[model samples]
Target: MAGSTDVAKVYERFISLVREVHWLNRISDLLSWDQQVMMPPKGVSARSEQYAVLSGLAHDRLAGNEMADLLAHLEAHSDELDEDQRVNVREVRRSHDRARKVPRELIQEIVTTEGLSQKHWLEAKQKDDFSIFAPWLEKMVALKRRVADAIGYEKTPYDPLLDEFEPHTTSEEVAGVLEGLKPALVELVRRIESSSIRPRREILERSFPIAKQEEFGAWIVRLMGFDFEAGRIDRSPHPFCSGANGDVRITTRYKEDYIPASLFGLMHETGHGLYDQGLDPKHEGTPRGFTVSLGVHESQSRLWENLVGRSMHFWRFAFPFLQAF
Candidate 1:
C-alpha cells in the first residue's frame, strides 16, 4: 500500500481535492479572460451561462459533504498540526460554513450581476459617463443589499460587500476610516500641490514595449523569490492572481507608455503568490489551508506593493535592474 488509512491517506485525498477544485477554478479563468477580451460582442448571454456553470461547480465543491469530510478529518487532527496547518483547516471550515449558508441560486445571481456590473462599469468608465452605469450600479446595489440581508449582518448591508474585500470589517468602521482619511488625504494633497517640487512626470510614461515589459515583469517576479515552477502570470484589463495553492496564476494589463501598469502589478500579485505559496500544504484543500480572510489577503497585496515595492531597500536592490532599460 502507498500508505495506511491514517493522516497519509487523508493527505492523498486532499491531493485529489486540490486537483478537482483547481480545475473548476481554471475554467473560471478562461471565462473571465474571454469575457474581458475574446468573447464576441454578442456573447453576453452564453457567457453568463458558462460562468454560472463554473461558479456552480466551485460552489458545490466547497459546500458539498466531500469538502466537509476532508475538513472534518483534518480538523480532528487539529491539535497535532502546526500553526499553519491549523490556520488552513480553520479557513477551510470557515469557507464551507459561509458558502453553505447561502443558496446556490443566490450565488448564481450575485455572480451574474457582478459580471454584468463590471461590463457596464467598463463601458461607462470608457465613455466618461456615469449615467449609463447608474442604473446597472443601482440594480447591482439592490441585489447586493439583498445578498447582505440573506447573508445576515450585524448592522448594515454594506458589511457583506466590505466583507468580500475586507473580512470582519463593518460599514460603519469603513466609513469612519474614510471620514478620517478623506480630510487627511485632502490636506496632504493640498500641501503637496502647493509645493514647488513635483514627482518626475514621465518616469513611468516613457515608451516601453509590451513584449519587453512582460519579460521584465517575469524577471522581477523571479528575483522576489517567486517559484515559477509553481505558478505563472497572464494578461487582463484588471490584473488578478488566482489558482490552486501551489499553482498560483497572476495577471496584469500592459500599457506601452506606463511602466507602472505591469511591472508593479506583477509584484503586487507576487505578494499574493508568496502568501499562497506559504500556506501549509499539509492542510491544502481544507479550511485551514487557504487565506485567513480577504483582509488578510489584501494585507499581503498591500505589503508587497507599498512595504516592499516602494522601499529604499527594494529600490536599491532593483532600481539598477530597472535602469538597465
Candidate 2:
C-alpha cells in the first residue's frame, strides 16, 4: 500500500485520525445506548452535556482542513494506489464528503437529542408502550432526515443512513438484495417448522447462575486475548463494544434460564473490542487507522462469532466454561 516513506507517513497520519474518530464515535454511541438501557435516571442531564462536547469535538476533528489536504494528496497519485489502497482512498473520500457537510452545532444538537431519546426509549420499552416515546422518536427521525439532507444523496432520503454502514451501496440496492433472499428465507422457515428431528432444549433451561455467567463472560474475553489493560466489560440489554483510544467498553446481557445466550454474546462483542484494540496506535487520530468501513466492522464481529466462536478450537476452550456454569 505504501508508495514511499512519504506516502507511508501520510497513511500513518491518516490511520491516526481514523483511530481517534472511531474511538470517539463508538464511545459516544455506546454511552448513549447505555443511558437508555442501563444508566440511572439521575444521570440524564449530565450525560447530555457530555455527549454534546464529544459530538462537537468529533465533528470538528473529521471536518478539519488537514483532512482535505491529505485527501487531495492521495487523490493526486491515484494511479499508484494498490487495490486495497484504492479502496481506502475511495472510502475516505466518501466519509470526508459527509463529514464536511454537517455543522458542528447540528451535531451537538443531535447528540443531545440522542441522550434524551434514549432515556425516554427505555421508559417506553419498560412500559411496553410506544406513544410515551413517540415524540422523541419523531424528533430523532426529523434530525436524521436533516442529517440525510446535509450528507447529500442522488436517490432516496434514507440513502445517507444506509451509507453510514456500507460504502457505495444504497437503500434501493439493499432492498433488492433482501427481496431476492425473502423466498429462500420463507422456505427455510417452513422446512424448519415441518422438521421431524427435535433436539431437546432442556439442557440449556437448567439453572444458570448470574454470577457464574458474568465470570464465564469475563473468562471468554480473556481467552480471546482482548486486553483488559486497555478495555473493560459491563452488562446491558443488548450487547455491544465501543471506546475511545485504548479505553474500549463492552456490554452484554445475562439470561439465567439459558446457558449460551450471554456467553456467545459476550464473545461477539469481544470480537469488536479486539479489532479496536488491534488498530495501529501510530495512526491513532486518522481515518485510515480506524476500520475501512462499518460492513468490515460487522465482518469482524461475525468472524469472531461465527468463524472463531463456533470453531472447534474456540469451543474446545470455551465449552468447558459454559459447561461449568
Which one is best on TM-score?
2
Q: On residues 72-140, what C-alpha lDDT tens digit does candidate 1 reach at each position? A: 887776655657556655655766777777787877886777666777787887798999899988887
Q: Please report the TM-score between candidate 2 and the true structure.
A: 0.79
Give per-residue lDDT, candidate 1, residue 227.
84
lDDT of each: 0.76, 0.78
Model 1 backbone overlap count: 11
What is candidate 1's TM-score against the reference? 0.75
TM per model? 0.75, 0.79
Worst 10 residues of 1 by lDDT: 1-10
- Across 1-325, the per-residue lDDT of candidate 2 in tens digits comes to 3466677677658656755666677767777756845688899988999999887877776788887888787778767666656666777677778989987888888889877777577678779899989999889889888999998789888998887878678988889999999999999999999999787979768778989989877887898899999988887767877764587788888888985788778878888888889887755544545665677777878888888877879778767767876
Off by over 4 Å in 1: 1-30, 33-44, 57-101, 116-119, 125-132, 176-187
Off by over 4 Å in 2: 1-40, 64-93, 307-320
Give the number of the best model, judged by lDDT. Answer: 2
Clashes per candidate, residues 3 or more apart or on different chains: 11, 11
